[model samples]
Target chain A: MTGVSGGAGAPRLLQVAGLSAGYSGEDVVHDVSLHVDEGEAVTVIGSNGAGKSTLFRAIMSLVTPSSGTVTFDGNDVTTTATHRITRMGLAYVPAERHLFGDMSVAENLLLGSYPRRPDPERLAMVYDVFPRLAERRNQHARTMSGGEQQMLAVGRALMSKPKLLMLDEPTTGLSPLLATEAYRALAELKAGGLTIVVAEQQVPLALELAQRGYVLENGRFTLEGTTDELADDPEVQRAYLGVA
Target chain B: MISALMDGVVLGLQYGLLGVGLTLIYGLAGVINLAHGQVAVMGAIVVSLAMEADVPAVPAILIGLAAAAVFMLLVDATLMRAVYRQEGESRILLGLLIMLGVGFVIDGVLEWRYPIQQLGLRIGGEPIPILGVPMSTGSLLATAVTVVIGLVLVVFFRSTALGRGVRSVIQDEQGAMLVGIDPARVRTFVFGLSGLLAALVAVTRAMTGPVGVSSTISFTILALIVAVVGGLGSVSGAFAAGVLLGVVDRLSSFYIGTYVTTIILLLCAAITIVARPAGLFGRSH
Candidate 1:
């Protein structure tokens, strides 16, 4: 169990205790426990196939946990449906960036705000975050470049005005500049007091923007500390940062 | 010629209504409902029975539509639910076979109970002359109803949240799930709506001309042709193709012979498949 306190008396916004999730009766995520307090940005950094995505999916209720309890904002949500979990102010931006290719960018953004009324202010905020999206609001999402689509995916998740936003591999295929821009957006969101949980293979960027992070290997948390501590850890450097 | 053209337009609209339901179901649920025409027949049977029992035209039609919708909901819940759980070719093949059996059962039951040769609505009014062509009150009313239903569907898909949710499912099922749209609920709603549209077609047929129990197969074939010609999932494409085929059918039957009309329709469908396999308006996947 890794307890990164939010503040002196801040309430815990999310708590996962003994979560064991899997596919086809075989456990992949084994007895993982973690917590995120209010106004915190946490990252789970791992290599490919380390089960980081599965952990996030379990948290979003997209995948059923074989055994565990997930408490979000003081309510048990381990067995809840994915949409219900989303409606409860937790938004997930999946890795595939599953934008309705035929639908316009504006329509995709509008769908993000589906759990609540479509607010013009939210739309404006999303556009403000990604000015290129504003320029191509009426364009089909499929026609956009990879970087723009990533931006759109992040912006779409933000439209829901969720208390906790979980993004899976937000900068996976972006150019160096675009990845920086994405991290900049995340930093901006974190600065705005939005709690975020990001699962990423991009170790340095994830560590840089997140206040605290967990190093995950084989579906288990290997190390947990503040970003500075993890960056300074010799084991993390040899494996993730390519430093010996 | 003008009267034939006008009649063709009306018939085209009816075909569009009939095909739209099938298109939507296929587009969203990926299920080809072989029971579609039989469901319409069931609705027609209800209307006919209600009329025989002294029910008024409006109420009888409404009752029939509701019954068809309810029946489809049952079909979706009981049969299609299992079909959807399967994957790939198995899903398609199983859906076809199951719905085919369902259609046959419905047809057999209706034949056994009703035993009626033909049924027609008893709409009372004088023929109205338009551009020197006399159009019956019933035909005009059916056309008007078709147009209204089409408009309502357009608005529903464009403006309503539920409708948007359905579209989202159509585009990407997993993505829709992530955004909190339940695909199962959307599927059920679409299946029910499809049945309601078929029921509307039955009522329109009863109003404009006699609808025999044996005509279910013909109606299904016609609707399938329209859907394919228009592009299976595009509503506007289906409507346009229905109108085009209806006009072509009427013109060919008049100029050549009734036998040649079927040949021409088949040729149109074949050409469309060869040229644009996705149908006229369907996005090429």
Candidate 2:
């Protein structure tokens, strides 16, 4: 079988086309399309209530798309169950970080490899990425501080050694210092050749970590370019970079 | 008094087993199985019928447990399919009504056809002394089995990957899904396990006294009290509540009238709900 690896003209690792999804017959995310290539980091930058979460949810099959298609690693998976999509190497860490609160940090990480035995090497790698998780391995996820919990969420997702990692607002409740620290870890993961698609209100951090970026405004991609090009755009600068 | 206390302990273990099934189902599915006791009785009756047909006790008990498990799996696949489709309050309400209806149907059938069917296991041996109280061989054996099963459950939940997957679904279903664990599959498995557990309790209880079709309602009531007092969905909590309530049951029956024991137990449940809605060992839902 031909894999999704890219040399030239190969299928992208993930492709979403004409996706419009919402709740109760009301469209929250209008017709939107995006793609991520193998071993590349891409970011979708948008503001609050801009339907970023809705787009991610649709891609994960958590929210049924009213009309659209999602192809992942050469398979059309628009209507697959969330768990099946997850097992297909798409790991998502949402803004709210739907963590198993009653479970210990270690337990949560262990369950990241659900229906499969957790590899010790992956566990150690997560511990290396977030040493705080290593320290509080026995502590319940609910008891950890916001930064620590975020770290745990990311670490837990990494436990699967997923082919693609998508995180929505990973720095939601962290202090500025912790936010940068979280980004630093993401940078490290990207450098290690993990494919990443992160949706963020923290545009500068996301742009710095990603090679290319998409500007999602009002539930549509208003602009898409290399990080350098988008960073130079005055509209992007004024709106997302807090520059006048 | 010592003998009563010993009997209470034995009775409490059985109660804990009974409640564990109901609580596990509720914890994972957000649906209380009101037909839990009826299913347990159905298992007991199956065993009795097999024994009446000259089947050996061991094989008959195994067949009874399998019958109950299969029945629950069928229910999960059929009526529960609709119930699981509903979410939040509607789901809980629908599940309750359907299970209650199932309970009525099973109870009606059992009483209509097997009015005289009862399971009474006779373990011939001298009474064993525990804590200076003479305990019947059946009670001692049942207690041993319950304790062993309890330990196995604890280990399974704590150490096994599939078992932890069950707890993950209970803790946060969305999170479980993201981790590639299907909540629907987990619910179905737990529901079947609950049925097997319910049947197992019936088998153990028969060693002590006759388990008759008429005892269905009482078993259901006892299980409800145990689940409430222990905190629904908490295994350790259920066992803790069982022991405490069992002792209370015996002490009240000894000191007060036997007719009022159920009322007193119900009162304890009421007090628990009023004081701690999450239960003694449960997280607030």
Candidate 3:
């Protein structure tokens, strides 16, 4: 929360080049590359089985890359595993929105400081952004509503003091209002200059929150463009916005 | 006989500690640590070695704890790390097989250094009079140490960031990770902590129990039963189950013959599993 934001000349927060990775037997992501600059919000929109989640997993090092390099904050992290990446100030919050349901919301949030414990100021900053979390911090995360859990997941990531926050389909299970709130929170994060990446299925909403969007089909970059241009594209209209 | 009851209580306390450690490790790592008993033996051997070398008794015990922690940490880092986030009875079996390797390895090494000879290093001080019992200095030290460790573990699970981190992982590893807590590290520490607990049991067991034979393996089996009986990973459950087993072990041995004691305890454990699949003191997942 009270992080010393990186310098302006700092390298791109996340850079994935020629990254190909997937499960042990099957090659899910085929030589796909992506990047998110400092203070940038990028979203990857894809249909089911389109490799959106797989890309996130590969970048996070949960899934081993078949080949290619992933650099974060100017470090060659192509082979680094998930926790190593997290400690490097890159936090990945999954869409399944895994929050330690059995743990109190506050306890779950506190865990974000494990790698860098004894840092209370950062934790206090997370609470500052989400006042509701501070209010219900003592309550178990599982008992909270779907939207609250999503918020908690984001807050927990912030506790890591990540320069970049990557969320996988955070709004998939949320209500319309909750989804909007999620967008608002992410925007607030952008205003505060935290680089972000969101892998989403909601095309228009994803475009609205992010400055640029990437369309993924069958694990390849089917289309990439600015928010305005994609919104106006006929294919985008047909495949995503569902308009004539 | 009063002697029979006392012996049972002493044995039961040791079982309780082993059970707590085993259940905690199992809950967090989902693997059966067959080396729990051997770790205990290693602790006792370390302590005895330290004592024989004129190391202070208190430091000797602490060193044993540290040894257990470090050894278990290695086991998790090297062996158990790959098996994280997978849940199945087979995983448990695999864990047992792995520990089988660890057990033989540790026992083989320990046997070389410390022959299985009973060496009771009595505390230098005189035996303090307690409730009309003719207890020696060593017994008092062992009892006090066990009780203190039990209390510390309780506070740890409920209070410290380390303990809470552990609880969060147990509840949901993936969720815990989203918040930046690495389940892998927690599992390593928990497994090591289990080893430390085994060491504590070893110290007391060495002070008062059979020696020469590979007694660590036998006690691990007992500890596993107590852990399962107490319920997997329940803090209160481990302590409660340990005490109950201790009492049951004593009473049954006194009423029945020593030969039948094992049978009675096994029956009790089986009935408990049938009656409450979770445990007497724990809730099943």
DockQ (Cα-based) per candidate? 0.66, 0.88, 0.44
lDDT, candidate 1, B1-285, per-residue tens: 887788889988998888898888888877788888888988888887887889987898889899999999998999887899898889888988998898899889878986684569767889999889888999898999999999998898877778778888888887887777888889999989999899889889888888867878777777788888998777888899989988998888888888987789889989999999899987787
Q: What DockQ was computed for model 2?
A: 0.88
Chain A agreement with the truth for model 2, given as TM-score: 0.96
| Candidate 3 RMSD computed on C-alpha atoms after optimal superposition onto the true structure | 4.7
Maximum-lDDT candidate: 2
Runs in model 2 deviating more than 4 A are A1-11
Ranking by lDDT: 2, 1, 3
Model 3: per-residue Cα lDDT at residue A163: 91
Alpha-carbon runs more than 4 Å astray in model 3: A1-11, A118-125, B1-13, B49-56, B59-91, B104-116, B121-140, B176-188, B206-214, B280-285
Write one digit per residue (lDDT tens) for candidate 3, span A111-159. Answer: 7766456367877777777778889988988788888888898988888
Error of 3 at A151 (Å): 1.5
Per-prediction TM-score, please? 0.94, 0.98, 0.85
lDDT, model 1, position B231: 88
Deviation of model 2 at A102, angstroms: 0.9
Clash totals for all models, in order?
A: 0, 0, 0
Count backbone overlaps in model 2: 0
Q: After best superposition, candidate 3 residue B167: deviation in angstroms? A: 3.7
